[model samples]
Target: MLDQVHLPPLAQDFLAYLSLEKRYSPHTVQSYSLDLSQFFQYIQEQYGGIALDSVKAAHVQSWLALGLEGRKKAEDAHKRAQPPASAVTIRRKMSALKSFFKYALRKGAVKQSPMARVTGPKLPGRLPVFVDEHVMEKVETNQAGDDIPLFSDDFAGATRRMILRLLYHAGIRRAELTGLRDGSIDFSNGQMKVLGKGNKERIIPLGTAVLKELREYIAWRDAEFPGYAGGALLLTAHGKPVQAWDVYRTVRKALAQVTTLKKRSPHVLRHTFATHLMNNGADINAVKELLGHASLASTQVYTHNTIEKLRRVHEQAHPRG
Candidate 1:
């Protein structure tokens, strides 16, 4: 049932390399496969059997142009047509191409990369979306009042609450959180050995409050699932390992109670973590390490959110008028 119709042999080889050697997540590999497939399909239909290395810059340019305009005709009438890809998506595809070509060049599959000189669509710089500090506090506490607790006192409630707390306090990605095993948490050191993108590992320090919650949750989990043999740090009602979607939905529902942000995701907690750190005078480089970013550029985005917050405070509190 595997469709290898339009994918060129070299492209297929490159994808295997990404999966096997680069250790990219399946989702990332699948994305690269889709992007490469689109490019190769366009090349086969439009240019007719051009060699992989012989592919011109114009071919890549034309493919991107068609994607942006949504002008490419669907291969079949049964397929639902999608709108033009947004700039962000287009940029991602371009990056995929760049990475693929880099691999291809190293293997001598291509003389040079067509994407070397090709420029992708300019992406608009947007600040990281985060919940306000006060809202985040409500999300974490879920205190009992005249109303029901935000996170109830059941296993499901504890798992959901812990998911949010880990994401916010650790500033870890959804995948990192989902992939955590019992051994991933180093309780003795107050740190977590997170396996980030590309199988890279970094030690993220866990705060005292988060560590306390984690211990309580672990005790609760052991008692709730006495026969639990699963290795994942989090589990479902059936004592099965938690999947990415499980964490996403749990965070989504938890965030819905506390935030009005249009995009309520576990990632919002990550954003909130970095932003709060910057607001409290945490160094950007230090936050970068905590967030496990490969480069400072990626971490710098959170600084904008903090700067905007400072601007608001200055506007409201400064008595120049």
Candidate 2:
């Protein structure tokens, strides 16, 4: 929720920049808009005559505190109304605030950024949970895909399997998976351009193993639906471009067979890809680039997985008397 107060000229501009220049995905943009809107509403109702753009660090801390100018304002109504948000939620809200202030700083809208030195609640160090290597190997195996049943041959069984393999092997985000166009793939070069968040584009290369499967799938697709779409690479059984839901369903069904992940979403595959790479000794920076992560901090979480692997190896190898 954004602040109820009228947005300053700069705040509106910042939102526009996020939408136009930054090209944040719709879901992300919508969340940002709501977070800001909620903040503004809280400021107006709680502080009465306070200027939202001039909010200070204390305001941010107070907003994040339980029962203080939050979603359920006034202690009387929200009394004993569930505990406040967890520290993790507080941390994320702070991050959103930090990003907003940074944007404001860039535009010179606010002389001093409120979140410049603000600290949010300390987040608990939750160990990264990853699939066991043996389990992952079993899960990633493309063999079981052969025994799967299909509702129709329109998307074709092969198409579904190829989709699963691409997401796992390439570690491409689901949106990036859908964004792929036919011409975007370079068979000769063995790479494809991935459009990630913030309109950032990067090239993802595939090993010969994945490239071979891709070629076979493409050939099959062409034979089934010759002269189908203009540039879109993946298509539904009816030769329509792959949608987000299609990718979700494909990944979900595949994971149901291989993984016990409760959510079994495509992003879990992305996490699995990063964790596996780190455990195998891939450089953190290199993994960051491969995933198109904007900040190294975001990628560093994978280090936890590597550390866990090292601990296991040390415990097994070292003999303690």
Candidate 3:
């Protein structure tokens, strides 16, 4: 819930709009709240508490500068120095302020948005990391080249394997995977409905092999815990619903076997799914829909990976004159 007492009326109203009207996740709402609170506090400390409507672009720029340059205390030599925020962190704060002010403008709370002229620091371009196709194939089988079974044989092993497959094949986020219900999967249609960020729902198509594995896993799960009638699609060993960390640990452990990437998480599987699809000639718009991205820009990042792959192929195949 939003802290009503600390925030100004307009800020609180903006947060409420984000929660009720915009349908932002609790985490996202809390982030906006924190960002607004921090900015307000900074205003109070730096400028003796300026009115919300009175805040200007200069104040926003100064706050961003403070993020880059940690607050200094000249008198306290022994005090621990505050570290500067990362570009990403500052960028998020900037975004939060922009959104809040935009809301305020729409609601007629302010004559103009202070964040209108404020520009965030430029972020460096980073390509998404993904496991190689050969390595991914190796992930499904053991060292002896035997196909891993997801049946009544071993519940724990089957659960872990199923988690890895769902993340890779379905390309769902950790939260989406954990929040899934048994009814989310439409076996007849070979598709699964996932609730994504901002409470947006999207349908992802499942392949025959993945669908078969899912059926086997669900059958084993139901048989193992007959008394369990929970709505969650995935469960823990204790028959409780799976959490974010559960998905992360499973992906990390499984990916550790096939690849040595520094960052091995459920999102890497998501990246892998998109990267593979782009490499194999999947339409960008289709990939966007599959990944549940709100904009074509978000989905366009995968094209960078495709371009890099093509660069490598051209270098290898072309002969120098």
Candidate 4:
């Protein structure tokens, strides 16, 4: 999809800057590429392929308007129109254009950024969705009882359980979990190093229970795939490295058994991890470091969830009337 789009040389250079200088992940770079490609395609069709520096704020506004209101197909008069973009999608496209124009200005390609005059719609406040502590415990442990292990005694089961545990316990992003290496775990320090966004590494402390499970999982993995010398911590049944999609599918299937939440992904486990820590009175800064968040603002969303929980408790436990 990224290759299909014909981006100008300046756009390609901007993408290189994101990948090399900014150290953005491939997935993030691809998203920017897609957004830029779509914008350029619109510019080509609407304005007859104007130079980047000549593009005006009105062009940017028109492009955004088209996104908010679905564009009708030119060739098919009777065909249904494409659905309008959601607030989130429009915001992302706006961000992509802003970043690209900023980069172009720095490179002296553009005298000014059109996005300086543009504004995105304000998104409604939405709290992060996380599983309850009890629900997560049920998912981790046996449905019959808490003492027994939930996963089967097989290599596949062991890997799946490890994926779930690391996501929830370490509060690592899905990419960070997949990027983990065999050497990332330090048994002596009781902490594991996670490679987070922008290739930043953070150390997450592991509990004794998690350490015990890690040791068992390592033994099982080695035994199942003997003579395998891959550096990846997680592997498929064929001994190849596990991918991001594999992690998502594994988490989705496991969470489906316990949670009815529409979002049954590894991210839900990460959210659950942060929310549970906040609920249990963990400091915001400590949780921020544990989750490898770039700023306190990103970590503060969990506090709202904690406040909601406190409100519910007060309503049920306290009686004034």
Candidate 5:
């Protein structure tokens, strides 16, 4: 493992800029740091060592190739060769290099970035996986049954239901839902304020049923843990803040019984929300805003699922017999 002190100055500067100025989430910044550290370690091994700004496009390409080859094993003579990194992983590493070089150029640390000429490996397109509408409805309507462990009277049960409900109805990311405060929801207006990527805020309208459930959950939470005075909207039975994994586990447990879809996590609920909206004639732009997506391109992927739904409807309904 490369030590922090050993990282090149330019790389350090770029990471600092990402954290301090760009205000990227810690998770995102950590990913960039890991990607760059691996690249730099490859640099020390291959080229003895070179400044980040002085590195060329060929070096970046070589790094990608090495990443795919599993780090050129030197640990043991009889050690089994490791499998190559996936295309997605390689793409993210290259993206980090490209982003770092771009920042270096902007900061006048380098006159030109070698990544300007470097192109990432071609990645296979995968459609966003979502829960089927019938399955989702089943999960939503089915109360604290055998699959879902939590009962409404208990703290765990109420929180689990609230977690699933907000993710399905609001279509917000898990992080946004995790950071939600007591003030995030406006019961009167039936709207929710969500903090998305890069700390961007967006308002999501809530349905009447969702609003009613929110009110019930709040009342139950207060009565269950009266002394707690935290700002977080959701809390554990002990009145501690809810973490991301807590939400994930709750979502996973709730979804396991209903969804045969392999990726049964909270995010799939977001996809289901978007897919259902578009299938029911919601505008693409409107869904984009509700989803807190920065680009229309990101939102357009849901259209593929919608189009498939239309195709199935046409085949089933059109009978000229």
Candidate 6:
């Protein structure tokens, strides 16, 4: 199944744009490469290892069939063993193929986008589970005490707590937080440079509480690691840059202490941040821009939350028995 075959030229060009023109990092480039590679492998198997340029509509249809197979395999894995892929993983692979074909069509490398005419398998939306404002406030209250044992202690405990609050308060993604450096924070203007999807940059505003915690955390960090702090904001005990999983584990552990929400990942907190803002009367379009969602359709899930709340209010108040 691992034969060596060149990708369609369009995919190659896209990779060039991703790295040279867009300046995507190595990890991002590799992810796109894996996505495209998996797509082509599926296509090859569907078409009996046909030539790269020979693919047609039937091949695209077959790829969707392969997605179905992947899901079936997932179900069997649950009963007897571990699934090699989740629904989310399959969806992502499909998205990668869709983007690749679209790029090929746009560049005239392919006659048309195969994904345009082919229908992808529909997936149900699984809304994120996040703690309510009351519980989040409880977390804040619990973590508000001064640095124990010494004013300038390790600060790892306090710093990690601030990271959780920052993610919950601001709807930025985990990559945005992990990619952050000390210089990314423009404290005077109270904004942060957040690198989001596709390596795009945006400025995010911070609340007074997050800002205060960050300033104190920075001071504490400097005190502990004297002459060691360079730029990265969140760091290990040894002042090294924080990784993506580090932030995820911190959020998971913090949420476990104060909330019963099952999904406690950083992105869940980001989703909670948006829905809560909308419930509290923030503009929907404003949330779209802040979360760096390319389309408002992607940001419209919060509207569902609003609808549910209104339905409950109507049922409780406007009863006509």
The best candidate in terms of lDDT: 4
Give the TM-score of each candidate. Answer: 0.63, 0.61, 0.62, 0.63, 0.62, 0.60
The digit string of per-residue lDDT tens for model 3 on 166-275 reads 88888889999988898999999999999999999999999999899889989989998998785998877888888898888877877776678999989999999999
Candidate 4, residues 1-321, lDDT tens digits: the string is 333445899999999999999999999999999999988888887788898899998998898888888868873576567788988999999999999999899999999998999988778679988999898878667452446456676788778888989999998889998889989999999999988888888899999999999988888788888897859998887788889999999889877777788998889999999999999999999999998888999999999999998899998888951
Pairs with backbone N, CA or C atoms under 3 Å apart (clashes), candidate 5: none
Q: What are the per-residue Cα lDDT tens digits for candidate 2 across 1-321?
A: 234344555556767888899998888777776667766666766787475467898887777774223444355574344456777767767776788888877767678789876777677776555555665565445444466443234546677766777787788999999988877789899998888999998988888887887888788888888776566778887788889999898878767776576777888778878898888888899999999998999899989878877888889988961
lDDT of 5 by residue, 130-201 (tens): 888777776577644566534455678778888888899999999999999989999888899999999899
Positional deviation of residue 265's Cα in model 5 after best superposition, in angstroms: 1.5
Question: All predictions: root-mean-square deviation over Cα?
Answer: 10.8, 10.2, 10.9, 10.8, 10.5, 11.4
- Location of the lowest summed lDDT over 10 successive residues in candidate 2: 66-75
- Pick out the ten consecutive residues of candidate 1 with the lowest summed lDDT: 71-80
lDDT of 6 at 191: 84
Candidates' C-alpha lDDT: 0.86, 0.75, 0.85, 0.87, 0.84, 0.75
Ranking 4 against 6 by lDDT, winner: 4
At residue 111, candidate 5 shows an lDDT of 89
What is the Å distance of residue 174 in model 2 from its true position? 0.6
Task: Name the runs in model 2 displaced over 4 angstroms.
Answer: 1-118, 125-130, 144-155, 315-321
Q: Against the true structure, candidate 4 has what lDDT? A: 0.87
Better of 3 and 4 by lDDT: 4
Instruction: Supply the global lDDT for candidate 6.
Output: 0.75
lDDT tens digits, residue span 33-62, model 1: 999888887887788868887888898999
Poorly placed runs, candidate 4 (over 4 Å): 1-121, 144-150
- In lDDT terms, how accurate is model 5? 0.84
Candidate 3 residue 1 C-alpha distance from true site, Å: 52
